[model samples]
Target: MTIMSSTSLSSGLDSVTNKSYLLHFLQLLSTCMAFFLVTRESTWSVDISNWSMFVWCFCFAVTLLTLIAELCGLQDKLHFSWDRFLITSACYCALFCLSAAIIYPIIHLQIFPDGSPRHHVIAATAFSCIASVAYAVEVVWTCARTGEPSCSLLGLLKRLEIFVACVIFAFLSNTYPSERQPALVWCVAVYCICFILGAVAMLRHRCDCDESLPYSCLGFGQSVLAVLLYTTALVLWPLYQFNGDFGGQPQRSNELSCIDELTSYLCVWDQRLVVAILTAVNLLIYVADLVILTVVSDRGSTQGLRIPSSY
Candidate 1:
């Protein structure tokens, strides 16, 4: 009986390990290919290619490290939950690859000279897309297979909020025209603050230290704060960027003057619009998170107060 039980357990472990290994291996392979293809082109004048290379290299390194750590059982020695960390990392990697896949082609392909090798860009974009899909699948599979309460919908939301903030940061990094404007600075602060809070929440949960914290209260409070801050940003950003009275462009300029290298990647006007939209999207997400938390907490409290009949 003991021999049979050990054999069954070993088979289960092997099945689980095999799936994870295959997924991470695929992610590493695709990211490596994408990175190599882009670097081989040796085109750095565009500037945006740097971001592409960074994304591919980052994903490849992280995936390789994760696979190694898991295979060697190093995760058991970590202070935090390895599964949670993996899920969060995979989610961000997926988004990063997806953005790279989209942006790399848009910025480089159109600008490629007729005699230049555009196929490299095309192949790199394809590999990035594959890496993105693989990472996304890994996240979903891990969450579903583990079925950990911490990897629930709330966890997904937290990771998503962080990802959106990252995208906003990337767009803002292209240029900081709002540097002198206090309102825009405050908007950026809002993004930073909310992102930090979400990251903290994830950290606390993954580290198993949140049990002592008033989790529900803290989550609700943070959600409210995020909603308010994002609402302010959602209104202020568009006003300051699109209003003609503020010396802002009311429409995307079609003038060739807007066709410079910087604008070719993403114009200031378009970046502002994209940031505003993302802010609104995050605001809605926070509001949904708030509502869901409230409902869930209420249910929990009600269940706790329920009287059990004599059994």
Candidate 2:
């Protein structure tokens, strides 16, 4: 038993030298640097800095935990497919870091005094960007590899759907669109429901429990529902937010509250516009997801019909 344990440990160590493992290492390192740089500075006073810190810290902790699991061969013992989990983690971390990379500089750089503090924030942003790229590369690399169980084109689309929903939430948070109109409340609900469904679907697939569920049918139904929900948001968001008849600001206001020249942060009008655009984008993604799910489901049913005669 001791000898067997020694061999397992040795193999796990050797596995770290692979190219795939190297990407994980890079992610871990970059996130660590970003987190360290941000926390070392006194930027916690900024509200946005807290969000940025959460991104870096979350990514760093998850990546470190993933690496430890890999090195300890925990994947072999776990019920869920570790490879699939890794791909999912990579996709989310990439999007999270990318948001931080964009938002941190815009918010923090403008508020900070020009000196060492700004430089630290700059360095942190750079590392966040690096980590984002590294995780993205990891996903692309995994997808490109053949004979991988959970690496499907549909998987990438699912991730995009979730990420877009997240971005919409971020935009809505800044402007509080739901507070503006009752219609917008339903839009927020759509985002939340669809986001939760997408997350559950991904988790189910990763856990290898998809076989027990009507995955294709569920995906098709979810796609159709998401498309319909987002379509409502896409129309109502712009109508209520941009129409003069609805008491909405039709254009960018000269009001001081609407403009912040220093941070170049998005104004209320701009945020609403962004939410509208993202709603449209998510609608398109769901449309595409529906189409693909339809095709795949049809092919599956056809294949099922043909399998009985071969025996």
Candidate 3:
């Protein structure tokens, strides 16, 4: 009976190990394919900004490194370390950015000249949809495994926000192509505000510190960077627009006018107006994240210093 039991246990362990290896292999393969697609797309146009291409390449590289680390079983060694958290966060951000990039161009295809190829738009839309779904599923699985209240809730909310944004963009693209830009701009502003509010709530009632979990400092820094970038973009857009730098004939005048004088005046500068609103929201979000990081860090340090009583 002992021999039989031992044999069965050994067989079970082997089976589990084999399955793990297979899963890792598949992940590695998928990462490689994603990397290839992004790289190939980057090389297609010389007119494209180098910085944008570099960002995409960097994201894919980070993702590939993460997959390699997992396949080599190094994740077990560095699982709770900052290195692991950084890599995982980078992969998530990269994937999000890549998916956004794909979807953005497709949804705003009308913004481009008619001479541009249409095939790429269709391809990008398909890929972005597939990738977004996959990412959403991964988030659900992670939430299930971790069950960290604050983090899991945040992840779920972020996924929902992204999905909703995609849906709204799609609808705007199909139904109100002429108004899509302003609509999207407003959507972004609202999203930033909502995100800030959610972050505040989460930080106020964060779950207990988990050593293996990623630090909030990373998010704080990202928020700051986002604020800066959006502010700069907002400032530059007006300058470029007023300077007539976006060459091609000026926008045709609209005979339709609002009944209210203030509304009509605001409509004339819609682009700048939306950007300014977005920038303000981003700034608020940045401040909220900064506070969250400071509070969490202080709490973590205090917990570390507490001494347990002996019975």
Candidate 4:
């Protein structure tokens, strides 16, 4: 496996698929938990009638862009060619934004009342979707072509991809299929399913690679933390989903004598606060990720030159 030429330097980048997949899964899970918690606290109305559709649309568009990048493979070196990277990245970004425009209305984000400040919803939803798609594409593309062979562990990436798929499916199951109780149930199902899938995928890969554990990590550890945060969000979001299930039940609300057991559970545990805390923590983690990526880039200069670390 020894490298004989500079031509093989691109193998280290694991491409855009798995890394982007993990980041998006975590990002969405955070927002979902945040919205769930705020609504429970009676502090904010987390509107998603318009927001959810854009998320859905962006997911599809990114799926296509990542797949394409994965197939073509991009330049991966300590210093990438900015001109080519910018052009390709912009092309990929356009797809995500354009597709979301058509998809938002299909999922009932348009259900918001007329002339009641849909602009924020529109702008936020569109911006979030675009950034999400861009991040996934960029990271994945970077990984696939980089010289760091250790980052290409199939075991790691597969788990992340499965996690993202679970989130997408969980959201879809709520609308297209039958209505299920405890919106939290869907969130829980996604978390458990993704956790299981990732665990199995990692185990299946049987990676023998090793890296030192310290106060800092290279790229792979960052991906692991991202998945873990996503799992935490999934567990936390159930609190709010259950609230939605109970609140939406008009027939049960009318009949006080035969109160639903689930409603009793929601009343006892305020779902809003739980979701808000989870969302806040997840956002904090998201910020941490940006910091981690920046730090790694800063260290890139010392990479092949074998400069000693203060750590």
User: Which 10-residue span in candidate 1 carries the lowest summed lDDT?
Assistant: 302-311
Segments of candidate 1 deviating more than 4 angstroms: 113-116, 207-215, 254-257, 301-311
- Per-residue CA lDDT of model 3 for 110-182, tens digit only, reads 3333543434444444454454344334334433433433232223333333333333322222122134345
| Residue range with the least summed lDDT across 10 consecutive positions in model 2 | 302-311
Residues 1-311, candidate 4, lDDT per residue (tens digit)? 55544445554334334554565455444334433332343322322223344444444454455445544654243154432343233333333343343333333233344443344445444554554555445444444444332232221233234433433443333232124544545545544554564444333323211122112343445545555656555554543333445443233344442254423322213233333344444444434544544444466422332212210
The reply for model 3, stretches above 4 Å from the true place, is 1-56, 79-91, 98-103, 106-108, 111-116, 149-277, 284-311
Which candidate would rank higher by TM-score, 1 or 2? 1
Among residues 3 or more apart in sequence or in different chains, the pairs in candidate 1 whose N, CA or C atoms overlap within 3 Å are none
lDDT of 1: 0.75
Give stretches of model 4 more than 4 Å off: 1-108, 113-116, 148-161, 172-194, 200-311
Q: What TM-score would each prediction reach against the true structure?
A: 0.87, 0.81, 0.44, 0.29
Q: Which candidate gets the maximum lDDT versus the true structure? A: 1
* Per-residue lDDT of model 1, residues 2-22, tens digit only: 999999999998998999999
Off by over 4 Å in 2: 1-22, 43-50, 110-114, 141-146, 178-180, 207-215, 254-256, 260-264, 301-311
TM-score of 1: 0.87
- Better model by TM-score: candidate 1 vs candidate 4: 1
In TM-score terms, candidate 2 sits at 0.81
